[model samples]
Target chain A: MNLREVGLRDGLQLEAPIPLAAKLDILDAVAATGVRRVEVTSFVSPAAVPALADAEQLAAELGRWPDLAFSALVAGRGGARRAVAAGMADLEYVISASDGHSLANARRTTDEAVAAVPDIAKLAHDSGGRLEAILAVAWDCPFDGRTAVSRIVDLARRAVDLGADELCFGDTIGTTVPGRVTELLGRVREACPDVELGVHFHNTRGSGLACVLAALQAGITKIDASAGGLGGCPFAPGASGNIATEEVVYLLEESGVDTGVDLGKVLEAAAVVERAVGHELPSNLFRAGGPNRPRGRG
Target chain B: MNLREVGLRDGLQLEAPIPLAAKLDILDAVAATGVRRVEVTSFVSPAAVPALADAEQLAAELGRWPDLAFSALVAGRGGARRAVAAGMADLEYVISASDGHSLANARRTTDEAVAAVPDIAKLAHDSGGRLEAILAVAWDCPFDGRTAVSRIVDLARRAVDLGADELCFGDTIGTTVPGRVTELLGRVREACPDVELGVHFHNTRGSGLACVLAALQAGITKIDASAGGLGGCPFAPGASGNIATEEVVYLLEESGVDTGVDLGKVLEAAAVVERAVGHELPSNLFRAGGPNRPRGRG
Candidate 1:
């Protein structure tokens, strides 16, 4: 399984103002864990999400490792171009499928965001970095209720048609279940068989792992998760925490799905985040001390 | 989507010594919520679990309501006999599928526990109460590891042949996923076409709702849940919090699975337990304030 760590970008984006040194240190530490992909930061305006303003500084200090894919979230052509200039080799852009969230979150409509995807993809491609488009709230929008399956399918087609290397669907509201996941996957795969399908699940409803299980059953191999389940939507009130990365590995490995991630290392990264964020992570694996921790004898 | 609230028996068993009057109050409050079934208490020895020592006393004062079935967990023949004397109409006897958990949790081997099911069922039948056998650690055991699918299937057969009216699979250690649930159900259903199947899931891994989703997809109608995600295995370290009753209803209802449980009423009942337990319930629905709570105008 290809597990992408999104704690730095999506997770930290919701957290308190983290120091730049801590960001670089955390990014370097995460790279050491052998999870090939990490969404390092967002190239958006610092005023909106000040935590990730040091995207350039963090990417500049991002240590190189064999087969590591360092990526950043690019909101539009400006962020995409900035990411290219920042020495990033992979880029991911966010586009909410729900127009209401698109406006509430980004001050843009769904169509406006979709229109920007192609130009962002062009900039990423022209700058020699592969681009992936994340359909935020693809399954549900906290402001608009559930997003339609047909809507996501159409967006997948449009994103791919514009030259996205991958099309990632996100249950931004964390209200998705297996039925919804299976429903979306069946339609999306049929519509865009050539696209690499991925999903981002939040543990808000405690259905994160279930959604992952559903996605895995539907043959999705790429997943975006936060170490210690650290990410949440800032715009969506009460929407906190993504599916923990260790949880994804735990569920997959427990079910004999090889995630190729060391759970202990992930837990260690989680501990680092706990210290950086000054709070305990909400991840079950983080709190439970994992399955293989030594138990004290009475 | 039949939800059996188990806060009194399974949840309170792990909590601090809640007062008998408080227990009775919570039971009555939960009953008023229109939930069809509630596992009122356990008939185990007071020395073993002093919290539920007032089982018979509470049973005597149980408020009657139309179509409400109050049940109790009976450890063995003695407990079953005690429940019969107490006027319980439904009795669920627990047997661990994993040998280690069985010995550690109940001081018996798997076969010894299975052998006792016959007499217990006979006692239940003689007293005009139906019997159900719950295979604890049916999917995974903390003392042991994952309980083999075959083990639970064989236990299901023996319990049914011994006169159990229903067989319930329990994720005693909170280590089950949808894949494991689906695997166990397909084989259990095939082996016992005449018996009813149920499951008890804990949210220890945050996959409780997912496990319920899988079970429902596999045609399981009866589920055991604790109100407010209470309950934990005393012997299993870090295994705390069962699947929340309201979460089960919320998940099912959101997906069109009619639970016949009023979300508003369940939340009201959760509040009563929260005050009695002296802590805010950790259920998603409880914390999220339900799907219809008023949003701020600001």
Candidate 2:
């Protein structure tokens, strides 16, 4: 039930400009809710992700929160170097499972992406930072038909061998169900028993929480969730973002899994971001209020 | 894995005006997909539900789908009479388990609602129609904080005693999670072993499909879903519709459950309804397309 709040990175990636100061305010609020780990920003091109142009500034500002561990997203060697330079000692690197999305998104074949992993890892190690590899579209690929379990396992094994601190899989476009999640995670567990596994899910097709439950059952411990489900795939049109943090926390706590997040306070933080965004964010708990809070009051 | 499509009844209770002609078209599509049962409409004052104003006409048009057992929703004796008179032989008589919703929606206490069920059952049965006593808000009530399993089971027992042919429980407002679903279904199974059970769920809080999986594991053979997720709870503000039919069919078929519905075709029908409503429907399969279909056709 230990979940990483990914809203600042995943949620902001799909939106318009969010000031670094406003994002800092969000980070401060999230930290107070007892969510220790937060993916703060991605070191992608400012032109590509103008919303996260302040990645370096954001990561630098994060030095103020000594109790919280903040990470940044990086897609390539250059981005990894930038993330390290920005003072982000922890990095989540991604490569797509789908051939079409892989070529279109990162301009590389699967093998090329795998080859880049070691280089990125080496750079991170030399820079005194750590790297986590996340294979996107690990279950069902929107551009390809079905992503083979063998392929994802191979990627995970290679990533771990290449010095990845953790291996996370993404249902990039949310096409996965519990069966697929269990099947893939089972394979991952069998092949790489010692590596920590995390699941990153999108609620685009609405199987996000179901996938979380499946991942938990399959013996995986970590999950990636957005606050208000604010991220969508920049490469895949119509693709939505990661699961909401509030929704995930509610599910985890209700199932007797300890998420260590205060639901009411998290919802309040989500509300602040929603108001800052000028439209309702996709977080369900923020909209519906928490389990104990009355809907219309405060 | 028999799915009971309830879009016309539960889905239409919201603001979406799935036209009567489109309703029949969707019904025809559902029947063609090999669904065994479809809840066509609720025989209420058209004033309350202008969407189903042509309920009588729609039912008459569905006479040709002999294999699809049509059902209608009824809240009281008058609605039951209207359904029977319109040639619907199966009436789903509903009462909320929560006293607050029972009093607000039906203008009766929980006890009074239970007391009235017998007469309504007799009226429908005397007219050669079958009655299915539906217990709404079975998992968690939006009005009355948390509903007890004993209260639901007792009401279910009394309903069966009064001549209910089947029992259906709604995850009203979509507050149900997998653990809660397991506990609630276990209570019902313990209380009424022989009673055929059905599940009606909403996707308001994003756990509908997981709840469906839990229900299936609990040995529930029947489920309720809406096409394109058109329903909303008037009492539970901001909640979405029932589980989308396309998404449920995808999950069931992907998981090796024989739902007997061509999920690809179901998405086609969902697309039509989505277009008719002049807004993109919330159904995952409709937007993401089916897994087996060729990758970019959708």
Candidate 3:
């Protein structure tokens, strides 16, 4: 059970502007949890994601944690180059399977996003940074409605051909069910057997954990979770972002999966982000601790 | 697959008061969905559930839908009597398997709730009403924390011995995962072979649907859902209510299970409730629509 903490990025994206110091503090706490993969920030311009305006600064500061696998979201080729130049350990490039969200959010069609993967991959690889191609809105698109398995499979093939190291299918709008996750992951597995597959889900419609379970059953090993279920879908109206990291870690650890994460530590870090954002984060595990989690009783 | 729509009662319980006419209209729209079972309202004190204060009015009006299996929640012996006297076709008697939640929420211990089941069952039977005893807080207790499965099995046996026609286990706080649901349902099946099992899951922790899928695999045929994902657990802090009916219907229908519901009509009703509620409900199919659902080429 490999877990990627998405708090600094996804959690921050959902809130108002935070000081650059606060972002660094979140990174420092995340490092304390020993989470290897952390999506620190997006390389989009300040105009796009104003919260991530300090992406360059945070990336430079994150250099101190040399052993960590720090990633930055790259929406396009330009962002990919900027993120690579900023000394990111990995680049996560997103392409929506749904044309509506693709065109609306990324301002590029699925084909266009797929078309940029090779260049983006080259940009990351040239800088000694790994690249992961994410098929966002892979489950259901608010504009086009439900995305077909064939479309996701085709996109996975295209990204793999473009030298992507990993393929991730995202329930970008919280529109996926367990069965759909199972079916789509099965197709992605058969079509791109050699590539690593990751699962990203939102808890907007309350199917995030269900989708994660289905993905795990379908042989997916990587998952992305926000610290406090923070981020909202930029494309889908009223859609919340990724599942909470504390909740996901609690679920994984309690199920006897070796997540190598101390859920209590994750909850503590979640509290830090929760306080910095000045709002209650949407993670249940943080509010309701685990079965064996130490309360004041002990 | 059996889908019990709980929108009329559970859906309206948590929010600001909608008018009784609006409640009737919602129930009217739900009646058109061809759902075989519908939990209409609870006969609790109006002070406790202001949203469901017009329970008698709703029950009187619901007589027009003779084809639907309309049920009412009965918290105690008096609530059971009121539901039966109102001519409800089915009665749901809720008791907490955990001593803490039962004492805090229902003002009774587990032993006391178990003792009242026989009287409630008799009252329902005398009025020609079917009975289903729900073991709430079956997964975990809000006040006492983790509950033992053996205690839940003992409660199930007692409920069954009291002439209860069916048994339902609730993931009251969304604490149940797929593995736990599988184990609990399997134990219930072994202990009470003659009783039909229903799984009630809250999406609070985002594991409701996963637990539902596990229950289905464990041979539980009856599942409960609310329209628009309404209601929150009073025992479990910050917990969301039951799974969304539209999402569940979508999942079942797409997987070739016969839920005997009109998917489009349910979505229409969901839209009506979404408008009535004055906020966006957390139902994916209500917003995204299923892959096979026709929305006039968009």
Candidate 4:
């Protein structure tokens, strides 16, 4: 199983600013944890999310770990230009399935976002970078109650047709259950057998790992996790904590699923984020190993 | 799907002293939530765990809710004697598959505990009561790393042979994922086709509800949950928070499974438990409805 460490970009998107030095340090530490891929930074405007204002600086300095595959989130053609100019090879474009969420997220409707992907993908490909489309709120929309599974499948089809090398379904609000994961991801996988499908889940309902299991059973291999369960969904208020990478590793490995991630190193990286964030992270396995843990089996 | 509310028994067993009056009030409120069954109290010795010392008092007073079926945890012959004496009809006799946990919990070896179940069942039956055997640590044990699936099945068969009316598998450590759950529970159901099987899970590893879905898919109808996700496994120290009543009902009902539980009333009961425990409970849906929630899809 492949877990993309999104603790830095998607994680810090909602967090207070961490110094550039600290961000790089966490990036280096996360790479050291044997996470082969890391979503380094989102190339959105700094004014929109000031915390990740160091995206350009991070992409510049992050050439330090050439062995680690790095990816960034780009909003549109302009953001794609910045990411390609920054010498990043993998770029992720974002859109929402529902028009309400699409407007709130990108100030455009779902049709507009889909219509723009071809140009964005062509621009990225012209610059020698691979583009993948992330369908945010694919399962549950913050504005709309439940996003239709067919809508997500249509987006997957459209994204793949528009040169999306891969497709990722983001449960931005963390409200997805196993059955929905099976239903939606199953359809997406069926519609696009050659395309790679990934799942991004939040642990607000505490079913994140379970949703991961359902996704895996449905043949999804790529999952997005934060190092210390860091990150919150601003839309789904009080809905914070992506599934921790360490917790995901524990669940997968213990269930006889081979995940190349080193759990011990993931914990160390979690510690660094905990200290940097200046608060306890919401990871279950992270706290289970801390001083607050009573004597017994984990 | 039938949810057995374990908040009053399995939940309070690990908490600080809760006055008998408060326990009865919570029990009344829990019944008001439309839960058909409630594992109200344990018949263990009062000296062992003082938190549940009022079990006999609760059972004596709880005859008020005859419309709601009640069950209790009975350790051995003595506990069964007391349960039958209290006119409690449904008794859950427990033994761990791992000798270490059995000794730590009841000061008896696993085999010794199993050997005593027939007598306990006979006593309960002779007194017009039905007895069920819960195989604790059926999946994972704190002291023992991995409990063999064959050993759990053998125990289930033995318990059934000893006139046990039903079989329940307890994930006392909350570590069982969906695969193991499907595999082990599937085997148990096959090996004991005549026996009704139940599953009890903790949310320690955050796979509780997923395990529930897997179990239901495997034909299990009985589950144990605590209101507000309260309660920690005393043996599995870090294993706090059982799958919450409201959360389970929401998941099941949303997926088109009939749970027969009132979600609105469960939240009300959760509020009462939150106030009595003097701390916020660990349920996600419970907090989602509070001040922390933002306007969006559930």
Candidate 5:
């Protein structure tokens, strides 16, 4: 199974702006954990998200680890151009399924966002890059309440038809449960059978890891997690960080699944990010440590 | 499906001692949430568990809520006698399945602990109380590592033969995953088919709720949870609280499983406990609020 680390882009987007040097240190720690794929940063407007304003410079530093596979998140044609210009061949474009989150997050309607995806996909393909369309708020929306499964299925089909190579579902508010995860994966897969699928879940409501388990049971291998469980939707109030990478690794590894990532190194990386963030990250494994440690009286 | 609130006993056993007044207030809040059963306190030695030193006083206050079914935890004959004397008809007796933890937590071998159950059960039955044998460290032990499923099965049979009204497996150090949860439940059920089965899981390894899901899917309904996610084992190092009640209710209610408890009232009760504890509880739902709350840009 492939575990993609999104702590840099999705995780840091909500925190106060740290220096480029700190970002490099975190990236180095992340790479040292043997996580080959990382969402390095986003090409969003610098004024909108100052935390990731140094996306280009950080992307420039990717040459330090030529063996790692790096991807960047983009919102539109302009961001896509910047990602490709920075020599990144894998771009993730997010389109919210709910119009409420769409307008709030992308400043456009869901249809308008979908319309922009075809051009972005063409740009990515023309530049010999791969485009992954991430359907945000695919299960439940903050403003729209429960999202319609048909909306996600329709978007998945459209993204696949628009030359996108992969698709993912983002539980934007972390309100989804395992049943909904199974149903959505079934519907999306029925509609777009051959597309590689992934899931991005936040631990907002405590079902994040449960939903991840359901996704894995449904045969999904690509999972998006943040180091130290960093990152939340700045637009979604009460939302917490994405599922912690260290916790996910521990869960999968303990279940006899081969993640190929060093659990200790991941914890080390989480410690580095936690120190950089200057607060406790929302990772139970990071806080509790691993299972093999010595037991003592509390 | 029945959800038993163990925050007062299991949750508070790790926190600094709070007064009986605070405990009563928390109980009132918990009863208001429509939770019918609660493990109010434990009858262990005060020197061993000073946090629950007021077991007699706490049990005496149970008359305030006659509609709620209350239980107390006991380690052996002495604690069970105290529980019955204090007027609690339901008693939970804990026995460690692994000898390593059995020696540490109960200061006896697993066989010696099991041998005490018949006398405790006779006392409980003679006093018109029911005995729930809680098998601690059923899946993994801190010192002994992964416990043999046969050990748990053997103990379950012996506890049932000794007149245990119900059986529960305690993931003492919280090192279990969902697959292990399913396997243990299946094996134990195969051994004791007619006995009521439940699970007590710690979120120590980040799989508590997932294990809950697995147990629920495996046809077990009763679950043990802590309010505000407070509590950890003093003997089990690095272990956190049991699965949070609010998170369990949220997961069940959102998934169409009616837990018969009001989510809002549980959060209010959690708020009261959080104030009494003077620290953040580990419940993600308690911290994030319910799913229907308003959303705003961060």
Candidate 6:
């Protein structure tokens, strides 16, 4: 299974600004977990998201982990060009499925966002980078209420047609339940059977990990998570950070699913993130520790 | 689906002592959620658990919500008598599935605990109460390691034969995953097809709600949760609170399973719990709020 670590990018985006050196340290810790992929940072405007303004410098440091596949999140054609120019071979282009979220997040309608995907995908492909179209707000939109599964299906088809090498559904607000996860994933899989699929969930409403369980049962292999459960959508209301990578590792490894990521190393990375963020994280595993260690009276 | 709120009893057991008046206020908030059953408090020696030393005083106030069925946790025949005397018609008799936790929690071996069950059952039955044998540490025991399925199956049979009207498996250390949940529940259901089965999970490992999803999929309807996700076992090492009640209600109701709980009311109860405990609780829903209302920029 491919567990992508997005803490350095998504998680740090919502937190207080840490120095580039601190982010590199976090990257080293995340890479040490043996995870195959890491979303190094996002190629957004420095003025818009100051927390991730050092995307180019961060991308330049990616050569230290040749064994790891690193990706950057891009919002538009300009961000895609910047990411590819910085030598990032993998890129994730996000398009909110709902018009409300799209306008709030990207300053455009969902139709305009869809129209921009092809240009961004071409830019990524032209620069020898693979594009993953992340359909944010795929499950529920804070402004639009419950997202229509048919809308997500249509977006999945469009993304696949637009030269996206991979597709991921983002439960932006973490309101998705298992049944909805299964149903939506099943529909998308049927619509784009040949496309590689993944899921991004928030622990906002506490159904994040449960949705992962449902997705795993639905035959999904790629999962996007953050160290220490950091990062919430600045645009999506009532949202929290992505599911904790350590928690997901604990869940999968204990259930006999090999994620190839070391749980202890992930916990170490979470500790590093917690310190860097200057506060506690939302990860239960980070607080409770792993199962093997003795705790409480036992 | 019966979602039994255990915040007042199990949730408060691990926190600093709150006055009886504060507990009644929380109880009123909980009852307003429209949940049908609640584990009011545990009937134990005051010296052993000073936090719940006022179990009798709290039980005396149960008459305020005659529409709600109330249950109390009992460790032995004495506790059972006290609970019955306090007028709780629903009694949960807890016995650890593993001898390690059994000795730490009940000061007896599993055999001795099983032997004492018939007497406790008779006490509950003679007083017109139903007995639910809660098998604590039924999944992984912090002291004993992973509990064998055969051991749980054997205990389930004995508890049913000993006159338990219902059986509940407690993931005492919150180590159980979804596959194990389905497998264990399937085995127990096969062994005790005639008896009602339930589950008690802590979010220690962040698998609690995922485990709840698995149990619901396996057709196990009775779930144990705590408001604000409060509580942890003092005896079980590395344990956390039961799955948060509002989170479960959000998961269930959003997934089309009618828990008959008002999510807003449960969140109110969680707010009351947070204040009484003088700290933020572990519930994600409590922090993020529900799906409605505008949040963030959206």
Instruction: Give the best candidate by lDDT.
Output: 5
Per-residue lDDT for B1-298 in model 4, tens only?
A: 8888998887777778778888878888888888988888888888877888877788889778877888889888888888888878788999888998898888998899989888888887887777889999888777776899999999999888988999889888777787899999889988899898888887766667878888998989898898887777443332367788887887787678888788888888988987887765767667666312432211
Q: List model 2 lDDT by residue over A1-298, tens digit each.
A: 6778888877777677877778988888888788888888889999987988888788778778998988788989899989888778888888787777788778898778878888888777877777889898888775776888998898899888888978889877677789889999999989899888899887776677888999999988788886666666433322355787888888888788888998777877787677656555554455555664322100
Q: Comparing 3 and 5 by lDDT, which wins?
A: 5
Candidates' chain A TM-scores:
0.94, 0.93, 0.93, 0.95, 0.95, 0.95
Give the candidate number with the greatest TM-score: 5
TM-scores of the candidates are 0.92, 0.91, 0.85, 0.93, 0.97, 0.96
Clashing pairs in 3: none
Q: Which lDDT tens digits does candidate 6 get at residues B1-298?
A: 9999988888877666899999999989988998989998999888877889999899999899888898999998899888888877788988888898888887899989988888888888888889999998888887789899999999999999988999999887778899999999999999999899999888887888899989988999999998878877533322366789988998888888888888899988889988888876777777776556433221
Off by more than 4 A, model 4: A233-239, A290-298, B233-239, B290-298
lDDT of 1 by residue, B91-140 (tens): 99999888888898789999999899878988888888899998888876
CA lDDT, candidate 1, residue A298: 7
Ranking by TM-score: 5, 6, 4, 1, 2, 3
**TM-score of the first chain of model 6:** 0.95
Q: Evaluate all candidate structures by whole-model CA lDDT and list the values in order.
A: 0.79, 0.77, 0.76, 0.81, 0.86, 0.84
User: Between which residue pairs do clashes occur in model 2?
Assistant: A228-A283, A231-A241
Single out the weakest 10-residue window by summed lDDT for candidate 6 chain B. B289-298
- Model 2: CA > 4 A from native: A98-100, A126-128, A233-239, A276-279, A289-298, B16-19, B46-50, B233-238, B275-280, B287-298
Clashing pairs in 5: none
* Tens-digit lDDT string for candidate 3 (B113-147): 88988888888888887789989888787688777
Model 6, span A1-298: residue lDDT tens = 8999888887877666789889888988988998988888899989887888988888888888888898899888888888888998788988888898988899999888888878888887887878899998888897788889999999989888978999998887777888999999999999999999999888888888888888998999999998888777533322476899998999999889999899999999988987887766777777776656533221
lDDT of 5 by residue, B116-157 (tens): 988898888988989999998888788888899998999999
lDDT of 1: 0.79
> Model 4: DockQ against the native?
0.30
DockQ of 6: 0.50
